[model samples]
Target chain A: MGESILSGTVFAAGISVGPAILPGIFPLAPLLAFNPFTEPVGVIHYMIVGAVMFTAGVVCMALKRNALGVLMGIELVLNGANINFIAFSSPYLRGDGAPTLGLDGQLIALFVILLAAAEAAVALAITLNFYNNHATVDIDRADDLKG
Target chain B: MTGTIRMDSIFTSVLLHLPAPTAPVVAAVDWHSVLFLLFAGLACGFAIAVVAAENVVRMALYLVFSLAATAGLFFLAGADFLGAMQLMIYVGGTLVLLVFGVMLTAQAPLVSIKPSASDRALAGIAGAALLAVLLAAAVSVDAWRKPGVGEIPSPTATPLGMALVGVRVDDPPAGAPLTGRSGYMLPFEIVSVHLLVVLVGAAYLARAKRRKTPRAIDVLASSDPPSQGAVLAAAVPAVRTTSGAGGKSALLGGGH
Candidate 1:
């Protein structure tokens, strides 16, 4: 029994190591090719970071019960989009002599920040009104219109 | 054994002939990528923390850190004006307002309302799918994956300012048709008016009003379990009266 168990362990190790040693078969090999510390970052790097933030925001919006939490999620979503705009607009990030988005991207990001502030103010006001009316900030309790 | 000995002898000879160790070869660190990593890690980590944290105040705090780090990213990307705007308006103005809203409504049972297990599972699945799609799209673009040219452009504040007021002082890029680029003066005016309208509307919506009779919420509050009900019942009258009186005073002051 001990010999059989030892053989099974060896087999399992082999199975795990086989794909990792092969070039194309390794799943993470593609990702490992680019080293961010040694190589300069590009627009794609910023987009990936933005994507993570955007996902977290969507999850927050979907899962949170507090109105303010939802509002925070909205802010996160806007911020993720803003990062993309900044990355695309950056002259440094463009390769092959491509024309960057120039001032337009920064200008749009500015407007997004401005609009986000306005939206937050209005949303907070609406939330306050809802809180005063219902005496609760739990969105689940907002069922008066649910006919 | 003989073949192994022969291979060992050749390997030793190769090692002995190698150049003597002198200055250690250190790989040059790209400060831009290092800073990008630092800021991106902070932003993404805190953003996830905002989602994971149960406490409302902690979530707000995490959001603040995330946004501040995002401002650092903007600075790293060469948008000095936008970065400053992000710090002043987003972290300073909007987050402060959000915190105020949180403080105002954070009664005991409402501070951390845990979502149901099913809701969390569903949202997790959906968010994972969305992230996969977005990341795939982001990485699939070959042009975007190419390393940047590392050329820092001139300051954009002057051009941005000029463009906002109907002047396009910045030169067009090489080989680009310049005739179609339009100034943002029209949108700037519209945004200004929109902000004014939103300011008034929010104030109007949040104004305290006197009620002739107790509403459904008041009845519900009174019927709640004694511990929570007593606290809410006591707090409601105090808050209502204070805000109401304050609103009346403000209106009177405006009249004067």
Candidate 2:
């Protein structure tokens, strides 16, 4: 019984090891290691998703000449940060006895969403005004202030 | 139902014959990871699509889908109230933006604006570098990789509501002796006021401006420059708003 319990604990700990380094160790290593398909996810997985979204947002902002496209990028970036906050705040996603962000993270995320909304509204309004003044929404053409 | 019962019986029999120790752990599928992957992929993929698409309307549509997927992720992460709010407000914002897009694109000349290929390449390279840095930082943390305690906490919205009104119902973890966790009452009130201000300000800025003279473009296009100022002043009636600013009267209708 003691040996069985020890094995159970070992299995639980081993599941946390990510699948990247487990290729040749054991025949069933894929099942044992932390692949998203087989093993339960940790906070790292959520961070990865956030990072991808943020990168896409940055690319969108830098490449798009349309002012609205840039606004979309800003929203994506904010949403990425919000995802990180939610991951940290979730009790089920925290380590055993780990000092977690708890409610603080969620609260911060909520505020971020609210502020993002306000920011978007103001930004769209400004975009509209810019379009009116220049008769164009092409941000590349808005060079009136250029020396 | 009968098929499900028969399948369950077969599954039970197979499980009974297998090694007892690892059976429970092995059979349990990680639904959370599956859901996370699904939502995250949709969100990221649509975001990338938005970046790549040159058509303004298509970009707006992609953004709406991306944000909706993000709300799915929020729900998966257990922020139920936030997920709902994200759905409502983000979708509403997208709708307003879509209307703006339609309004702007009603004019045939400015429907799409494409960036040069060189700009796209440079932005892609920069984005990749940033992503590498972010991913490395995220993965380098040891504690964040650890498996969770695997227990669902109580509903988040009630305590969240309390916290917004200057009351914290949830206690800090026993191991960490934290000082009093102050609520977000101040920030909440401040944000509410800020939102109101933003709404009024946005309306003001976007409002049509009336000018007695023709638009700068029209003035520049005409040949005679000596009497341009006089001609503009006499061209339009004083009572007519002339689409507030520029020549957007056709697109915007009467200036509101």
Candidate 3:
């Protein structure tokens, strides 16, 4: 029972930390004395991770009938992009003097965020229009152009 | 002996006590990175689930979790101010707005809205492809992969604040210290204006929706006169049938 709950939370839900997994996979106690303040090894592995959020967001936007679902997709897409931008700007993660984006990446990310907000507003406006006219938000029904 | 030592503090000692082969894995694992990894995975996973789940309320919940995790990612990546901004603006402010919208629009029992299975399959494939392309592009470069990023001193929030006005604060390398780092003051101002507009717009959209009757409770109250104590009597199911039998529209007309 313990194993079932533990495994469910860890792998299925993606809640368990790597250290916990390591301790389970191998056999060792965590370094409680290893002060997190002192980061000897920097942020290489952080960038390599392909965010699953981005893909999920895409699927939602494409498949869902609700306007909110589409909006969530946009947020997810932005989040995925954000992971990259942050990884690039993070001095702790990048090589020393490796022509990293530094603050530029963050600046670009900020623009993307602003643009995304604008897009959401415009999309919501359009959605409200559709709702007023048709009384439903199902995009599939928006086939007046088909005839 | 175990009582004398806290289990976590004795990393080396704990390793000795545990079985072999894990020594290498334990030695390699960095706890600092572990925190970020867990949070990031959560933000990503819940986001996907939000897309999959049909319930709007549940979607909002997932979105809340995802945004919170992103804030954690920001702090972990050394964007402390940005992280705080994310929490304040994205989570606290924007999410509340989203919930309000959900509640308002949730008419007719407000339940799950399922899409076609074929649509789901197609989107899943498309999303998977996009992810593959993006992931491939992100990790393909050599500079990001093994950056060997040296010790970067955590900069003060003061400098970041200063640079928002168009000052390049992160130490520039060259003749005449490049003065072009634009402070974020302009964008911040713009975002403030944008949010104000959004608030006015959302309020305008939701104001005083016309309904046939005020409410179930109001309809009952209006049927009985206060002088005759009919208001109190109106609560009885027997009185409701007679008063309400006149048709709900008639009761509302009698209110005036």
The per-model DockQ list reads: 0.33, 0.36, 0.16
Candidate 3 residue lDDT tens string, B1-45: 334556544665566665333343223334445676677677877
TM-score of model 1 vs. true structure: 0.75
| TM agreement with the true structure for every prediction | 0.75, 0.75, 0.64
Q: For residues B114-161, could you state the per-residue lDDT of candidate 1 as single tens digits?
A: 999999899989999999989888776666767788877778899999
The stretch of ten residues in a row with the least summed lDDT in candidate 2 chain B is B222-231
Question: Model 2: residues >4 Å from true position, as ranges?
Answer: A1-33, B1-27, B106-109, B173-177, B210-256
Prediction 3 TM-score vs. true: 0.64
Candidate 3, residue A84: Cα displacement in angstroms equals: 1.8
Candidate 2 chain A lowest-lDDT run of ten? A1-10
Candidate number of the best lDDT:
1
Candidate lDDT scores, in order, read 0.80, 0.72, 0.60
RMSD of 2: 9.3
The per-prediction CA RMSD against the true structure, in angstroms, equals 14.1, 9.3, 14.2
lDDT digits (tens) for residues A1-147 of candidate 2:
223443356455656564555774443343346555445566777777889888888888888787777888888888889888888887777766656778888899889888888898888888876665455667886543342
Task: Provide the lDDT at B224 for model 2.
Answer: 20
User: Of 1 and 3, which scores higher on DockQ?
Assistant: 1
